[model samples]
Target: MSYKRVIRFIVFIALCVQAKQMVAQNANTRPNIIYIMSDDHAYQAISAYGYGLNHTPNIDKLAEQGVLFNRAFVTNSICGPSRAVMLTGKHSHVNGFKDNHSTFDGSQQTVAKLLHNNGYTTAVIGKWHLISDPQGFDYWNVVPGQGEYYNPDFIENGVKKRVPGYITNITTDFAINWLDSRDKSKPFFLMYQQKAPHRNWMPEEKYYHLFDSTQFPVPANYFDDYQTRTKAAHEQAMEVARDMHDAYDLKLAFDLPKDQQKGLAGNWQGIYNRLTPEEKKKWEAAYGPSIEAFKKANLSGKELAIWKYQRYMRDYLRCVQSVDDNVGRLMEYLKANGLDKNTIIIYTSDQGFYLGEHGWFDKRFMYEESFRTPLIVKWPGVTNKKIASNSMVQNLDFAETILDMAGLPIPADMQGKSFVPVLKGKKKGDVHEALYYHFYENQEHKVAKHIGVRTDRYKLIYFYENNEWEMYDLKKDKSEMKNVYNDPSYSKVKSMMQKKLMELKKQYNDPVPVVTPQI
Candidate 1:
């Protein structure tokens, strides 16, 4: 061969050797990741977050073992959209999940896809409510709709099947089942998302009597008037009282019609179906009077509020109990298989919720309750155990963090910076000097669609749709009860936040108006 041809062959051999070594390096570095998320599970609901209202021992144990993020937030504090953020590692604007109405564009580049390309086994199990066919999942079994209390329908492997089991139990069962069968050769990434403690809070039969006698405390801001809020605060039909129908699932009306002359049989539906015409008429008359009499004898004042609290909290806590118990089950499974040490376990919710805080039940407001999410990370040989980080972290940061953890390049398209630095105890003070929030397309349980920004201690929200602005010095008004934006003392603070907001908009290519609308 000629000298030039000999040189070309040597270069080709060198390239082949380099390619094989790179593949081997990628193979050795992948980590097993288990991500568990619950619906409407607030940071305050977790005992680790220091809320005494609920008991969450297993979840608390996670905080004891891993680093707990003091301040982690979602760009949008809703279900489907937040999940999209986690999957795509991008904002709603980029992911096309601007709201629940928009479906997930899974064909686009995703974290799952990236991980899968880098040789990680990926599976998503539980409530996949993107409202479209899921993508980037090797195996997926998810609840359809809000699912059910008794028999739930789960769409699995492209087939919808009715599983004769409790919703929370079944979702966890599927999650464990996936984990048990995961490929051990390559490290895995499993998304265990649950439909717990969401709307119409219902628990399994075993957990039905869990909180039978407990008097769950009412949220601090449960009786808030809409004096300083938007039309949404006054119009949303999700209030604890004054909004529920008598026949609603909660059934707190306490008026069951007793058979006047006879008694209800075991087969009430059959008995009623076979009732004689005259017997039916008598039953109706008796039932109407019985229900009315109970209604007329109203339970109001403190008595009524306590009843509402009991109903709301009992159901809520029961759902949480199921979720916590299932977490224990997953942990036990990991220990048994010897995967606990090498695996990184994360538990959190789609977004923080208002558990009767400020007289509200739903989220989506720029308030701390909705904006702040519960993020607990237990990374193998990475996170500082038992360290509680009070830095402000956004869910958007997860995209960067997850990719960086796996030693993959975080795409420039993802605006969220990596907090993996903070988790590893490399940085101090605030992670993000400021966090931006924008909520658009305002419908669901009726939370106002507004855009806002949160700094270390102060929050400023601009109600663009309503042309109103609210500013809060979070250190003083943690409950966010007072708006001091109009005060002369905060004019300087407001101006600075507004300028920061403008800088973020320009940086992110979002040009929101800074002009004040004429009232």
Candidate 2:
């Protein structure tokens, strides 16, 4: 009980405090990052968003633990371009990958390259549709293009090899495998992406009957005649009733007589053609009854439209269910390995999709369903817990935010402003007053090239190819049923929006290209 004994106890306590401080410092200095993206995953379908079409428990868990942005949008609402925007932190025009037809320039600076140079190991798995070998990752294994649902071939490290399994589950497996093998000493960034609920929605065999007993009500605007819309809407070919094929899309005409198949048999045979005999047997066993019933029903007109919508919803939601299941798998892996504590996890989509809205099933428009995407961010120690932010953010902001979170310098050339402050519930004001969008793909869906601006209460779009303008008061017309560009009551608002749209284009350096309408 002397001075030496007391000094010894004090020294032990100080050593313990020093070790605790060093642990906190390491956790803050180099936190790992995991960004999970789903193709054509709409905000409306997630149960957390309250649209009530289907449940996504894993995605909802991400929202429950972190910040969910209610107004997250995309710069361009297409597959390849949306990813390009996120990688480059610039609009599609600035990145030079404006549409699916174009190849991304690999030599350009990407966020991955930046992170890789700044002391972070980077990997991108699944659904890399950029049409170029991934340039800036320590490792990459991606699907070719709009990858198949069953037994898909993956381009792993530039070698094409067929992987045997459902696409979503296989993707998750590879992502976790990479995580297991990564260098533990260095922080890592992984883009675990998925291809599901995309066109010709194909669910895994296990979820074949998941939504069979559930009846989904048709969207009120599902029968929209495109009365108030412009030529862009009426001339498009994405109608669920007309464009969704029985053979390929709905998987119904496989049993019908080839002569009675309405000539769609040739176009859609590939989806079924890819399945092995055993896989095909399982798939048919699950869907055969519905196909037989549909053939016997003799549906036509509104009855046929409703029937097609329900089939579309069932298959789409089933695919989503598989995605949700895989998400849970990844979450469990992270938790089990003790990586959940210091890793910043993000869940989003390349862009939103139309779930039978406006009689359409594809995404290219500037409408709310396609333009607005789901964004959930979970930063273990930084983000506000279980909060939803109304601040308008975009896919463009993702790269800058990642760099910011990693304690790295955001390159000045990257155009996207980091919304990390918004995620932390700080600096709410000064978020952009309007978000700009531009879509350039014309030959695919017949939707004309367009540019527009969206604010909280209103949206203004210009169909440049058609030389038409459409405006909507979003507060009143969330469905975008009525375009009020020419309405006298909205003239003042239209003028202001028009000016703002042009200003945004200038601000983003997206000049409208001169069009010549192929002779």
Candidate 3:
């Protein structure tokens, strides 16, 4: 061969080797991600939000280190649909998981599949309430259908196994184990989820008596009359005093007579049956005194209501305590493995819950307590110090934000915009001029199906089924007690909100028909 040809060949080989090294370096430097989500965790309960209900020091650390979103919300305030939105970055209707009764379509595109295809190891552990088995993950161990609190069963990679321990602790164990065993050559993403603080709150044995003596103050509107609201508020079956059951919700012993047991006696019994003899003995010992006192008090009227509220708060907060402790465990694991600096940590909930707001315990309405969730994110370089944003972000943005953080191209079909710019302080003020919400479940809580839009200072809602409209001026009526739709002085504001609501509906392709205001 000629000398000139040999020199060209050597240069080509050098260029190829340099390109390969660049690609490898880029892949290694990408940040690992840990997405931790809990079920029905209200923002008011987090001490970082300044509600003063209870202290969550470990979960609060994320807020202390990163950005705390004050106005984060969900597309739909229910479980399955909210998770579906987070996975697909689409509204419930677009994702085809509108409510808990529907099964999640596993064949569709998801953030997990996108990341997994792009050379990242992915896994999800804990509550997988989406009915179908998790798809597109290298590993998944999920609890089936709300899951048990004590000695729960988990479906690990499609195999059912009964693990003997508290559900929160067991779920954390699985997550940490996966992190330990994952292939170390590539960056990883994990969805560490928890099922605590949901309905029928059950705490671990260690926290059984944690809040037994504390007397939590009742909400000011605990006796909400629902007079100025739509009929839906008056008809919901989630009131703490009226709808909550003794055995199922309160965890009192099954001592009531068969006629007065209200068909809820068996629920607690079934959960108690899952515990071993030793565990059951400890549980009964912790709760025995309260059970006896409740029965002897013969409580009636408002006094009885107060008693029930205290019981509910204690159990619910206890469960939250376990979740916080487990979050600390995961944080320690990451720090110990030296992944803390290179990993992005996110803490949020599927959706917000109602902690005695409006005389309610569950979440379904478009009210602030149910619609707004807790969102805290810690990015090593971008958000290393404490800051906050009131940008109207939603769970819809989660998938896009995750993909953006990993330097992957977000699919065009996703309806959510990445908030990374806001997180990096490149953007200021709200990311959206208006936020849209819809709820379709009309079965359990009996909350009427409604669609609404929330702007910076106003909200407009339409109960299409009831042919009713409710408007709230959030600046003056944060609690949403008054309906200003019919007031003439705010006619222009109502009309403006209605127009914005219609625009959102059209943009999102929601098929709900528009109803003219009845004013």
Predicted model with the maximum TM-score: 3
Question: What does candidate 2's lDDT look like per residue over 208-258, in tens digits?
Answer: 888889889889999999899898999998999998876778887554455
Instruction: Report how far off residue 211 is in candidate 3 (Å).
Output: 1.6
TM-score of 3: 0.95
The TM-score values for the models, in the order shown, are 0.85, 0.92, 0.95
- Residues 1-519 of candidate 3 have per-residue lDDT tens digits of 899999999999999999877656755699999999999999998999999989999988988889999999999999999999999999998999999999999999999999999989999999999999999999999999999998999999999999999999999999999999997777899999999989899888888888877989898888899878989888889999999977789877644555554456766667767988888788888888989998899999999889899999999999999999999999999899888888999999999998888889989899999999999999998898889898889999999999999999999999998999988999888878899999999999799999999999999888999988899999999999998988898999988998898889999999877666543
Model 2 residue 469 lDDT score: 85
Of the pair 1 and 3, which is ahead by TM-score? 3
Q: Which digits, one per residue and each the tens of the lDDT, describe model 1 over residues 229-337?
A: 6565677666666554343334332233555313223223332433446545654553455356547768887666556656777778888988898898888888998
Task: Judging by lDDT against the true structure, name the best candidate.
Answer: 3
Q: In model 3, how large is the Cα lDDT of residue 327?
A: 93
Clashing pairs in 1: 221-358, 221-359, 222-359
Could you tell me how far off, in angstroms, the CA of residue 441 lies in candidate 3 after the best superposition? 0.3
**Which of 2 and 3 is ahead in TM-score?**
3
**Of 2 and 3, the candidate ranking higher by lDDT:** 3
